[model samples]
Target: MKRRGVPPALLDAFLVLVALIDTWANVGFDRGAPLGCALLASFALVLRRHLPLTTFLLTLPTALVTDAVFATLVALYTLSSLNRHRVLLGICALTYAVIDFLPWPWSNLRATELAGTRNVVHILYSVASAAAPVFLGQLVQARRELSLRLSEITEARENERLLTAQSVLAKERAQLAREMHDVVSHQVSLIAVQAGALQVGSGDPETKSAAATIRRLSVQTLDELRHMVSVLRASGSRPTELTPQPSLADLQRLVDGSGIEAELKTDLPGDLPPATQRAVYRTVQEALTNVRKHAPGARAIVAIHHMNGTIGLTVTNTAPTQAPLPLPGAHHGLVGLRQRAELLGGSITSGPTSDGGYELHLELPIGTT
Candidate 1:
């Protein structure tokens, strides 16, 4: 385990202290030359972390003369841990072994005295002192590299999981769009055809008007449904050719076909954007559909008022004279209209009128494509 709370400077000072004590014991401090070499070797420990090779070279001469083993061991450990240069480590280890084993004029006399009987023990001690620190440093380096690799692998797995989830969601959305186009579109088209036939066959003005409203609304619903289906199918692919969306000009055909007594009032620009025109057309269609379904035989007034930077639409119906038919309602028409308006940075509201009828109001920003 690594020591905590001990700063590097303090550790270096401790190594130097240990080296000084060992040098004094092995080679007397009374001799100026041997004492100076020992002090210089110990001082080199301060440079171990920043300049390990320089520190290792400085301690070689002292290791040959006196027993300044602490400073030599610390310098070797720093060189192995920080530099990671195998060639430099091999050269330093060889130099240290030669210096430690070879007899010299300034050699530690007490250690050299057991040269005959303790030769093997002396060799093992010298090798262990030199090799232990380097081995420990390499182990530490290996552990750090393993931890980094594990972290990178974990991050890659998480990213892959997120991408898989997104792909599944996209596939599900596309499937739903296909189902709506195949099932709901066919039924809505049938309703429009039946309403058109009813309008032609009915003799009463109220019945004809109601039938006409249903037909127009059904057609508009189909158009919007087609657009939604196309969008879902496109996903990330190239756009497919779509039918031309209806605009304000198509409102006349809608009103005429509605078979109801309805009036449209507007002075909209001839060059209004396509999106704005579509929104206006759909809003009117939904309101008329509600009138046909809930208040049959009611006269509807559609008023489009253009103001500075905004377009306002109001569809108001008088009280009904005939009862509503028991036709199946999807019940999502008004919710869809509200979502459409909000998407264009606009709003829509509808409620019962005091005159026992219903009214819907829409405010959409102009130039919003």
Candidate 2:
């Protein structure tokens, strides 16, 4: 409730002091009467923060009964600046009407010899007192509403800026993924092919030693590719090597060493595009890794089926004997994987399976594949 250049509490206290002074000035030497009115007005000021409506109600009666201009001004300002105008307006109108007709001590004084002169002064006093409060209250209320609207507009602009930043980030990551895939695939494939050929055909001991070095180099190159991909995906720095990415043909090997006795059934369509095949391979790789991490000691089943114009893959594992390792602070792994699949016009879902196991299913539409 602080305002520019002045704190709200301090401002309220100053207003209350002004109202008290006005009360004393208006009452004059009424033998403790002015003191009582000033105290009541000041006490009403303290209620401004928590019960502004009640404070306004309390002040309005004092304003109407007393001839204190500053007390009425403080009440009007609190209502308009701190509370809403519609309620303040209705209260002020009713209060003024009641005070105009009331049989007060001052009203009784205007009945006798000096009645004409006293009536003139009273009329002037009523016009100035009533009009000033109403005008100032409306002015303050309008300013408060304008400030609130401006704040709402500022918040909306900030949200738009945040959305724009996220969209730009997603596009940058997509471009990085494209560049890294192109660069690493060619280099790693060339190294693996050259190493395999030299290992089989070479006869010299030196050539044999060179082939072994090439094999180790090829493994290191693949590891480097994974690290670069993880970094680009905004997953954490640490790399976990689990079941390797399997092509359509590696279904048997995936099942054989999954650390659980299992079976794999595949009806993968031949002539699938290279990118689609890679996506499917990555999906299966992640699914198997999840099984090992979260469902250890549970026998699993892997299946890749071609149905209609889409490739569907499912991996299911029974409930594990022990709880899975707590995920290290790398929350972005699954998020990044889903983004990858979506870019290739595919979707993936992984969660607990019915019948006491977990399942992961991925689907890639044929046109995108």
Candidate 3:
């Protein structure tokens, strides 16, 4: 497939054009061998992507026979970028340096002449230049691989988040089932028993018939409740939620135990619904927990307000004064808190502050269930 922004065919054509220009600048038009070899190297770039090794081999003759080595360098870079064989790339680069440094005719290789200072410097320069393309290509390959790894990690984390959310929902449903069975069903059973006693003991026909109807309906309701309880228990639920949930009254105790320097200020009414109060308390709890975890020794401010039918909260923490010790966590606190806020018809917004601090904001409508 063609790439975005720059088409592959166009890029290949451009590379070939540059190679032709290099050849033109280096070789005289009257020299038949140099011109033919340089042209062959220049045209070979079109096959570099599919057959990098073959392309590099095709271009090597130009480096050996003439000064037009641009095509050879480009081909070497292409091969290094595509192939993961370090030994082969090293050999190819060394061979290019040797070909570029040596005298053309094998018979003219004199030991004393090759040992000169100027020739030695030229040889070192040739080796360095040959290694440049290979290094650059490998760097590009590394960056490309890193990007792919990061993408895979991000996708995996998203799947894990979804699973965690499903698990949380299943547990909540199971808890609801337990509540219905232990409380609502118990009350209904009591009413059914009382109705049965009235049906058997009452003398009035109308009252007896009413009692019988009530008992029958209550029994049917209990059967449906049992079925629902069974279905909920069969679901893949984890542990039950913690009992005796926190409330606004527990805000002070939560902060005192949070291990961070924090100040709480709020103007919320005392008559808020239990769920709304719990949401606020949990928001403060989670925010303070994060401050202690991520921003060690940082001062925090928890400000909550109720104005114009909106319950707004802001938890802001300063930059860490000391590095925090690494702690094992499921990283589910914020996910669960967000789920709670969403259920209450609200939203959570969080990010870094301008003073190198982190802030979390929760906005919920007043009296939301």
Candidates in descending TM-score order: 3, 1, 2
After superposition, the stretches of candidate 3 with alpha carbons farther than 4 Å from their true spots are: 1-5, 28-30, 236-369
Clash pairs, candidate 2, are none
Candidate with top lDDT is 3
By TM-score, the better pick of 1 and 2 is 1
Q: What is the lDDT for 268 in model 1?
A: 86
* Each model's lDDT: 0.83, 0.69, 0.90
Give the winner by TM-score: 2 or 3: 3
TM-score of each model, in listed order: 0.56, 0.52, 0.59
What clash count does candidate 3 reach? 0
To one decimal, what is the Cα RMSD in angstroms of model 3 from the true structure? 18.6
Off by over 4 Å in 2: 1-4, 32-35, 60-65, 85-88, 97-103, 106-128, 230-369
- List the lowest-lDDT window of 10 residues for candidate 3: 234-243
Q: What's the distance in Å from true for residue 29, model 2?
A: 3.9
